[model samples]
Target: MCGSTVERFFRGISEFIFHTKLGVADVQLVDYVSDLMLRFVRVDSLYSLRQSDGMRTKHVVQMISEAERRIGLAKREVYRHVGDFTLFWSGMYPESLSAKKNRGESPDQLIDYCRQGKRAYAIAAEIEGGADRPSSELIHRMSEHFEMCAYGLREVRRHWEEDDDSNGLLTW
Candidate 1:
């Protein structure tokens, strides 16, 4: 495997932030909370790459696979920080969709372990229902996935603003 391809998600996120001026202005502030920010940024970048209009060459399949893989990995990392809604919907909003479960660590909490990367193909299976699903339906589900990711990014924005108390908003 190409080392650069293996690192595409992180590099893509940095590139996206640099080009779009969407990154935090001060390195110190962002680095102070790198653990919380990295997963949120990586997943957002992966999905943004997926929705890109770039022409698919022979290697495009790998990019899609990488996006799906990174999404799962990000979800897992986020799960370690908080239960429910690794991809969104469960805890991103002003209110919980249901009574909150026991609060896990919030994103601002620090950790020292590297998480395993994964793919969401099985998760997709749950949403897609079966192999015979129509192309349009799959496309719709993919779009929903993107929207949920946007919410996930928004949640990150909220956490950044209330770093010490992010769990308070999330626990609602």
Candidate 2:
């Protein structure tokens, strides 16, 4: 896709980790996850889903409720956003969730991120009518392999932490 240097950086690391270390050779999945990482690097992108009052939706339940109120591609995209949201947090920074829980700040304390993520992806994959089969199939595969992808993301975080040159790269 000839993205920016930052995107390329994420793609390179994601490819090496997901394909080589994690044995997930699906190029589409790797690309999707890499792009997701790239997108979520920004605080605004991480919480891009907004309410009618223009407030960012912080909780997954609220996101799901909003998704249910939509129709067509918009609904599908919101569901997909939910999946991405859950995966990004649960995979990349699970320890933060624990910390939040201990401090009584975990908004999703009673919710299961993995189950909701997989279900959201499945719902997203089922939407639309063959207008974009490739994306639908990719999202479907994401649902089927959600756990592996989440594990792969955890490994990605570990690999990045072990690398000394990755400092401040994701800040941009």
The lDDT per prediction is 0.33, 0.88
lDDT, model 2, position 35: 85
Instruction: Encode model 2's per-residue lDDT on 58-168: one tens digit a residue.
Output: 989889999999898889999999999999988999887677667876577778889999999999999873555438889999999999998989998888776745674
**Candidate 2 clash figure, as a count:** 0
Taking all chains together, each candidate's TM-score versus the true structure is 0.20, 0.89
lDDT (10s digit) by residue, model 1, range 91-167: 24424322222243332123211111012322332343334432334333333444333343454545435744755
- Model 2 misplaced regions, further than 4 Å: 129-134, 165-172
Q: What is the C-alpha RMSD of each candidate to the true structure, in Å?
A: 17.3, 2.6
- Which pairs of residues clash in candidate 1, taking residues 3 or more apart in a chain or in different chains? none
TM-score (C-alpha) between model 1 and the true structure = 0.20
Cα error, residue 25 of model 1, in Å, equals: 34
Q: Which run of 10 residues does model 2 get worst, by summed lDDT? A: 163-172
What would the TM-score be for candidate 2 when compared with the true structure? 0.89
